[model samples]
Target: MTMAEKATDQAQRNTEIVLTAMRELFAEKDITALDRYWAEPYVQHSPQMASGLDTLRAVVPDLEGFSWEPKRIAAQGDLVFTHSIVHGWAPNPVVIVDIFRLDDGRIVEHWDVIQDLISAEATVDGNPMV
Candidate 1:
């Protein structure tokens, strides 16, 4: 494989690692993977979450009714973006686009854009959000 191909393969693997950990952490409520996959100076742009890996670990289990499942994931270099469905987080399901910056195979920074999945009646366009 070419050098670019190798880099792409590595990036894909990194994204896969993050997605797998997210599934385990969110769906299974397993915080054990946090320290292993995330760094101490975790920068969180989402107003709902705090910084630090410890904070995430502490907060994960308390999200009793919420389940975040990744619908699509893509990565380039050290950054990975995932579109996910967040069920039970609100009265209606929410679609979230989460972006993460990874270094040395661990997550160092994060940001997200979340939107409530509006009802069919409320939506103007006849298209699904997620």
Candidate 2:
């Protein structure tokens, strides 16, 4: 495979790792597994909260059940984009878009936009328009 193809493959694998860890974290209502996927200075851009990994670790427990299904992924260079649906206590189905920047085969930064998937107008192309 070409270098770009290899990078894409690696990025896809990394995305899977992060997604699985996130799902496991929510299913167990714990952040232990999530720590392995997020960087120390991780940044989150969500409507509800914006913080680093440490803060997320502290707040995850307060959330009841959390699980997500990643639907699409695309990557180029060091960035990967993912569209998914998150299901949990606060909302039944929340559309979320996550962007991750990877460094040396590990995720170093993250940004996400989440919206409640309630009405038909709230969704577009099977994802939240954010």
Q: Which lDDT tens digits does candidate 2 get at residues 20-97? A: 656666666667775566665666666566667766777778776667677887877778888887777354677778
For residues 5-72, could you state the per-residue lDDT of candidate 1 as single tens digits?
A: 98898898889878877877778787888867888689988898788887787777777688888888
What Cα-based lDDT does every candidate model obtain? Answer: 0.84, 0.70
How well does candidate 1 match the true structure in TM-score terms? Answer: 0.89
Error of 2 at 98 (Å): 1.3
For candidate 1, give the lDDT of residue 126.
62
How big is the positional error of residue 84 in model 1, measured in Å on the Cα after superposition?
A: 1.2
lDDT of 1 at 43: 92
